[model samples]
Target chain A: MIKKVLIAEDHESVNISVEKTLEELGMTQTDYVYYCDDALARIQKGVQDDQSYDLLITDLSFIKDSRVQKISGGLELIPAVRQVQPDLRIIVFSVSCIPSTIEMLFGQSDIDGYVCKGRNDAKALKEAIETVAKNQRYFPRHLTQKIRQKNVHDFTEYDIKIITLLANGMRQKDIPAYLIEEGTKPAGLSSIEKRLNYIKETLEFTKNEQLIAFCKDMGII
Target chain B: MIKKVLIAEDHESVNISVEKTLEELGMTQTDYVYYCDDALARIQKGVQDDQSYDLLITDLSFIKDSRVQKISGGLELIPAVRQVQPDLRIIVFSVSCIPSTIEMLFGQSDIDGYVCKGRNDAKALKEAIETVAKNQRYFPRHLTQKIRQKNVHDFTEYDIKIITLLANGMRQKDIPAYLIEEGTKPAGLSSIEKRLNYIKETLEFTKNEQLIAFCKDMGII
Candidate 1:
């Protein structure tokens, strides 16, 4: 039932909440640590005692509170901990809802779950822990559509510039002039239309408003 | 002692949860609407009938359903509703916890509370509703430090470039040449030093590491 959990977060308030959450989930043997170095050490010691932790919950950004440690943030600490305990389940509990950042984390690490620590976090965290315990990854339902849109078409600066301009009430034909003035490559109306068409086709949208709205909703613009 | 409340959120699940939260807060007269236009209309009717709502809870983003409306998102709706019923209390409950976005909302509107609609949202919303009822502004405790840091030093694209470079392991002395290569203005070493010094002094940090860490923690870098 995915027992022993190690929580690596600096905030005492967050720690208390997470601990309470763990208790509710029936995972009683949870260890809390503020520093990543200490968290790693706890895992190592657990391994040595032949009682390794089943999961590790961490926050991406850690405050450098007078503690000089080898690992700085949760991102760095993940890779380091994986080297020592490759089988350890990881869930990122942080404030960043940036699609690219979440995409990067899932791309870079073997994170089992991610729950943003605001709003209905306890419920989300409970869902994440349960899902991860069943050996499945938990992507936020609210952001899955946006993240899926991300996978469908990667946005370049050129595409963003075009969309952003359109969002700002720029005429479609006038985009080429702005691109040319900005020294952007393929500074042609055909190129802009083609680029936008590619996105429309990928997203299966018939109208320009739909295209713009989709990008805006997904934070691509 | 705020009693009568109106909620404007598109998602049914979110509405249910928010309704429950309001119910728990002893607010019995809670009305839910899925569109911003309807929310505005309700407020207008409330005023005309002399049965005014005490508070309005809204989500920043609303899905464009089959209805054509003057007000689109909660942000636009806030101002429109304010014009109709200027004395109504407002609490923005959304998934956006972005510091600058919150700052802009506070700058643009007389919003009484802003609670992010994610993990711990019910609790945050309860706090927000209670706080706003007593005629107080409720800012998220976690993001307040970052927002205050924002008021202390506004970061421009140039400042972001320098800090991002430093965060990426670039040397302090090498920043000028990099900025020059990128064709950024005021790309001299002295300008870079002065900018860094200004930020450091404003944030009350003596060392570059402290400045960098503070920026990183605040998501400015």
Candidate 2:
């Protein structure tokens, strides 16, 4: 049972959110600190006091404060805390949706979960906590991609054109109309659908938006 | 004497925080809608019923829902609502700190205020509301930099290196130490300070972090 948790977010509103979510999950012994140095000190104090926290939820970037500290960002804080309390379940709460940065965190920092801060962040936080408590790693459900997918196809100019249109807010169904109007080949709806499906499989993506975001991450479009 | 207020935000926790802030400021008639369309509808309904809201606080990015909406984003909703009721005071509460986008919102959408969502957002919202009530425009104070500063300098390779180091989380004081270790010329703290201050002045940025962020936005680092 993950009862004691430490939240290392700077935003008061975000802290209120995480607190509310933790309360809903029946966990009340949660402590919060806004600074990375302060978070490290709290974790150290907790371990020394024999009241070690079970989980650590932190933001990647803490706004710069007046005081200078060696452990500046959450990236610095995570490894330092791991040295002090290796078993602490850690989840990053940040606005960064960059997959490469997130993948690096999971690999290097060994965080237990990650939840992007946004519209359904509270719901995502609840799910992340529940999932992490079950000894499984959690990633944002909507933004998750098959990063392990190495089945790369040499993307043609036409494929890039279609994906670029999709990225520019053109509806998936409306792509064929634009292509047809532009006098591009395979402008039929069925052809567009088949091509998109093939691209999705090549990238191992389950949704069009995920494919778009991946293309953005890889600078493909 | 701003009385009735409407909050358009998707996050439940953010709504609670906003509602709580409103309550603390002695406003109980504040209504919250999770969608941009719902917010516009409420405003329209209020006008017809002769009970128009005095202020509208909205997030720029609303989460996508099941039903498709004609007014997809806050940018679209603002102008549409402006046509219906030109006197309605509007405040944007968004995660975007981009100065150019905010400047455009003020110029095009005629929004009364802009508050960045972050560590001090709740406090910033309070200040923005108080300031806007006086018939003034509100921009996030900490992030404010003169966007009209047209003075351009051909930045040297050394300048980019310094700003990049700052952006990479090196404290200004520690910068000289790193530069000295690298055998870079003018590695003294005073020389670094003088150069940084000159850059800030050139960019019309009052803070080092602002200078770093501006360099990032311009792709100079």
The DockQ scores of all candidates, in the order shown, are 0.04, 0.11
State the lDDT of candidate 1 residue by residue for B151-198, as single tens digits: 567767688778767655566788788888889989898999999899
In model 1, where do residues sit more than 4 Å from their true spots? A4-52, A57-74, A92-108, A114-128, A137-221, B5-52, B57-72, B92-108, B114-131, B136-221
Clashing pairs in 2: none
Best by lDDT: 2
Error of 2 at A130 (Å): 3.5
Write the residue-wise lDDT of candidate 2 on B1-221 in tens digits.
Answer: 79999998887668778877787788789999888888899999999999999999988877676767777778788998898889999999886565566777899889999987767788888888889989998977654544554355446668877876765546678888899899898898898889988976776656553454445434354
Model 1 interface RMSD, one decimal = 16.5
Interface C-alpha RMSD per candidate, 1 decimal:
16.5, 14.9
Superposition error at B204 for model 1 (Å): 19
Is model 1 an incorrect, acceptable, medium or high docking prediction? Answer: incorrect
Candidate 2, lDDT over the whole model: 0.78
lDDT at A56 for candidate 2? 98
